[model samples]
Target: MDNFWFNQSDYEYEVVEPCTYQNNHSVELLVGQYVHSIICILGFVGNSLVIVTYAFYKRTKSMTDVYLLNVAIADLLFVVSLPIIVYNKLSSWSMGPVACKLLHGSYSVNLYSGMLLLACISTDRYIAIVQARRSFRLRSLPRSRLICAIVWTFAFLLSVPTFYFYNWYEPLHTQDVYMYDGHEKNLTTPQFVCEFRFTNNSTAWTTKVAVPSTQLAVGFFLPLLIMTVCYTAIIVKLLSVRNFQRHKAVRVVMAVVVVFVACHLPYNIVLFYDTVIMFQHQMCEASDALQVAKTVTQTIAYLHCCLNPVLYAFVGVKFRNHFRSIIQDLWCLGKRYIAPRRFSRVASEVFVSTRRSVDGSSDNGSSLTM
Candidate 1:
């Protein structure tokens, strides 16, 4: 590893070329921020609602529904960390040391959990539908619960090393400088940096990179391949049997695959990039291009937190109906509150009373009685 001087303290500061004072704002950043915030809120709310509504409102205890519940739970847990990314975008990691580790750990855990749960979903659907003759007693609630427990536990276990390694560092890099007094002085300042540092030992490599890479292979890619094969077989079977149930079932399974690919791809890409690609480049000098790449990739990764809810809309008819009802109810509530009959009646009664009194007629409000 190349030795580079960096501020090891909690806070560092540096003086850079000051920008000319201007009130003009950046539209791109603003738009990105808005999109990120909205997605975070939607993911949080949508996933949570899925869990709550399914758990309470719906009573059928199918293995498929249980896995869907697990997915929602995983997604919600993942989205819980998005606010930190949102804040990281707006500023830097103002969150203290504890929060930094927990957020990163939770994020990683849920990322793994989501993929595992999706795999479970795909596998369960395939078994229930394709291998219908087999005793799918494994798909019972107890078995489903056990699988969910194992999936979550494994996700947490996989994320443990990340939790241990990641930390909040205040980085200060040397910069060439010129002072106002015609003298040059290199200045140091605190930049809230989020990075992982493991002891320079052999175990660090295996623990950090090799193990995680293996987990990615086992947890993500293997299941994805299995799903592809299962879906292919299922599709061939469904095509042979021309019936509505087979078509609907195939649609549901396909929707799961599409959702899994769309939402989880960015997160897996981020993991691959950070663990494999960036490992070699971490020691390289930080250039604007590298910084931009990191920012864009991270943004894409965080965008996954929002995609699950959109997937729910596409895949789950129940979710679409639920969402539509929620929107309609909210709209009705807004109209009822904003233009209530009580306020309008009060104003009209006041005007009618005033008019009747001004006419010097009967003080009783006869004309406006109702």
Candidate 2:
């Protein structure tokens, strides 16, 4: 939740330049735990619904739908881990090194994968609209699938370091933790918490400087750059078109760009600030301020996972229709099973996918691009 390896602490750290905050952390801790729990539940359900609706209930799909399906899958993968992160942050990491490695790796993979998929979606949209008459070789569905595979493979490879560095270390002081037995008891003991560390100085340098810098650039900035350019070009092209709903297309493009920047920019800014502080060895009150800022901003970014479905549900007409169909089918199913053993009236027909015109209008799925 707090980036890949960064965690907040209420007490001063011994070997790490005494990175402690002067403010009372009780509010932050209490709010963070519950918010994480709530977001975990909502994000899981939202992402799962997106995937299920697109995968099963929708019989028709454009190239945009394929990209969105993968996006939903990636978000769901990360959403399921929020509860574990909540437990780890509220309590300590009790799941051992294997669990820590898996969680960290999954987080990194999910982060980069979602960003890359958004970039891909934007590029696909650019090709679909701006280069609608050109770039014939790149618009095929099979090509889109190949591009997605490449994106996933690249994201997974970039995140492999998280698996390697997620090792445990013993804290210098004893921690008071609760134990489960016949009855609950609190006891003091030396505990191990999850952290990213390396023995060799060179490896440490790479982990601290190179890996995160690359993540900051490729995972956050690059996708942002891609979307900005793509949407700008899309807007220009939309202006030139005299027919159809060009204004709607431009508004949708702008909305995608705005939502992405709104959700992700704050966290990246704080992350960059944290990196600068760490690299500069600035152990001052500013460090305390940045620590708090980082925690707050990271929470904002975590909301992005669930926000995707909400954004789509509002903007995409076909997505809303598909969701309505699913709800109606569910209601009819519930009425059939619970209200009576036999059908009292003719069953209502449920349409899985929304109908499209002969011109292959993509107003349904185009709103999904970041």
Candidate number of the best lDDT: 2
For 1-370, candidate 2 gives per-residue lDDT tens digits of 5657644675657664455565525535855678776778888888888887766666324566777788888889887876776567556678888888898889889899989988887887788777767646666678778888998889889988888887866664444556687664647654677878788988887688767787889998999999899889989988888855777767777777788888789988878866766657665677677777877777778888888776644367666766766676677767767765564343333222222221143444343332
Worst-scoring 10-residue span by lDDT in model 1: 361-370
Where does candidate 2 have its weakest 10-residue lDDT segment? 350-359
Q: How well is each residue in 140-251 modelled by candidate 1, as lDDT tens digits?
A: 7788899899988988888888788878876444244559688866564445755676667776676777655866696678778988987787788777898886687667
RMSD of 1: 14.7
lDDT of 1 at 273: 67
**Superposed model 2: Cα runs more than 4 Å off:** 1-17, 20-28, 173-187, 242-244, 312-314, 342-345, 348-370
Query: In order, what lDDT does every prediction score?
Result: 0.63, 0.73
Question: In model 1, which regions exceed 4 Å deviation?
Answer: 1-32, 172-189, 201-204, 248-252, 262-370
Task: Return the lDDT, model 2, position 109.
Answer: 90
What's the alpha carbon RMSD for model 2?
Answer: 9.4
| Colliding pairs, model 2 | none
User: Candidate 2 at 145: error in angstroms?
Assistant: 1.5
